[model samples]
Target: MGVDGVFVAEPVSNVLGGLACLLTMYVTVYRRLGR
Candidate 1:
């Protein structure tokens, strides 16, 4: 028999998005400083 896939939910979508933005900002700053 084949296995079935499962579904997951994330209620903190905005929080995750904010975290991503912060990470991106940090990377940008690091690159600018490294140059």
Candidate 2:
């Protein structure tokens, strides 16, 4: 159960991290263009 949990969590965390990175990049670009 512990191993399974880790496997499931790893992908979810990775996806969330990726999305956060994309969002940060998008915001930075948007602000730069806005100026």
Candidate 3:
């Protein structure tokens, strides 16, 4: 069960982490351009 849980959590964490990174970059870029 621990291994299965880790497997499931990994993909979800990756997706959320990717999304957070994208959002952070987008906001930073948008702020810098002042648009």
RMSD of 2: 0.9
What digit string (tens of lDDT, one per residue) describes model 1 on residues 1-35?
Answer: 22322222243566788899999999999999999
Provide the global lDDT of candidate 3 against the true structure.
0.97
- Number of the candidate with higher TM-score, 1 or 3: 3
- Pairs that clash in candidate 2: none
Candidate 2 lDDT score relative to the true structure = 0.98
RMSD (Å) per prediction: 6.2, 0.9, 1.5
Model 2, poorest ten-residue lDDT window? 1-10
| lDDT for position 11 in model 1 | 37
| Model 3 lDDT tens row, 1-35 | 69999999999999999999999999999999996
In order, candidate lDDTs are: 0.73, 0.98, 0.97
The alpha-carbon deviation from the true structure for residue 29 of candidate 2, after best TM-score superposition, in angstroms, is 0.1
Cα misplacement distance, residue 33 of candidate 2 (Å) = 0.2
Report the Cα lDDT for residue 7, model 1.
22
